[model samples]
Target: MSGNRLYLSVSLLLSVGYFWLGWSLMQPEPKHNFTPCLFKNVTGIACPSCGTTRSVLLITKGHLQEAALTNPLGLLAAIIMLTLPAWLLYDFFRREKTFYNNYSIAERFINKNKKIIIPITVSLMLGNWIWNICKGL
Candidate 1:
């Protein structure tokens, strides 16, 4: 009922979800086409996330270059998104007090750099999108 307990519970839930998500990656992906990007249908430009899933699939299939051509940001997205939940789980299980301790250096690094890092990441993804479009992906 306290804040720390609540956080611990949420972390456990996220850990379970991440475990399932990671497990699902080993299974077959479903076919779906519901792109919200107008670039795909209008100007014929590939959007930043246009082939993200396909790129991830190709990466899983060992087509590294093809994946990069499809979405250069795919690996970055995959690592951050997937690793976040994994880290949450790790902290929950390991009782990593550093995650809670404000003095933790890793926490300090994230807090200090996230603002600048996000915009740079966004720009990179957008650049990759334009590149993919130019490549006729």
Candidate 2:
């Protein structure tokens, strides 16, 4: 197979595996211990991505609110997890950056407002981190 095809196949497999692993981890008697978040382990503070795994697990189990409370970014991950396969399939057929082309206007807006965007992103991350810490995740 060509390199691009091989890469897409590998990516699709890994994405599916990730979702399956999340589902398996949510089982009633998971046989493995959950790994603590590395950033939290060293810093003793919740990172922006803290609780993301639990959030994904909760989302897989149909607990949307709990998933959001666990970590909003987890919701984003779930969306990506669900959509990536389709996107990859489309990309494999098209072999073009259609997503970027279609969203060029939005991309230009982001580039223009990069300074403003940075602060907003930082505040949102900080807020999420604070919420995670409050929940003692």
Candidate 3:
């Protein structure tokens, strides 16, 4: 598949996964964990993203504070999950490469600021991991 098609396919799949998660969450009692963190399973400690799924679900239910407490990364993930697919669809329908262009711009910006961005990102992730551990997620 072409790069654009690949991007679209992945985005659509993620959207479907989110829908499934929502459906599962609506059940009186969910029998399965849709998202299992491998790191947590192996290490017996919550990973930085361990609670992201719950966080995203809370966000969908309009519980912003609860979502934040679950995992701040979920807020970023939810934003991407909601916006990326729509942006990709718009680009596909309009025969535009706006998404790709923006992705390239972001890549360049990150590369240009890696020295600063990398440290900040690592620090944030470490902090989040500590938070997850303390929360017993």
On TM-score, the candidate that comes out on top is 3
Q: Which stretches of candidate 2 lie over 4 Å from their true place?
A: 1-34, 100-107
C-alpha TM-scores of all predictions: 0.55, 0.73, 0.83
Error of 3 at 126 (Å): 0.4
Maximum-lDDT candidate: 3
Tell me the lDDT of candidate 1: 0.67
> Per-residue lDDT tens digits of candidate 2, residues 36-125?
668877877788897777788889789999899889998988887777666666766888655445456677888999999989999999
Stronger candidate by TM-score (1 vs 3): 3
Candidate 1: tens digits of C-alpha lDDT, residues 43-94: 7667777776666667777888988777867666556556666666676788
Pairs that clash in candidate 3: none
Q: Residue 76, candidate 3: how far off, in angstroms? A: 1.0
Estimate the TM-score for candidate 3. 0.83
lDDT of 3 by residue, 4-123 (tens): 676767787887867866775876755664446788778788889888878888888999999999999989988978888788888889998888777778889999999999999999
After superposition on all C-alphas, the RMSD of every candidate to the true structure, in Å, is 5.5, 4.6, 2.9
Q: Any idea what lDDT model 3 has?
A: 0.84
Q: If both were scored by TM-score, which would come out higher, candidate 1 or candidate 2? A: 2
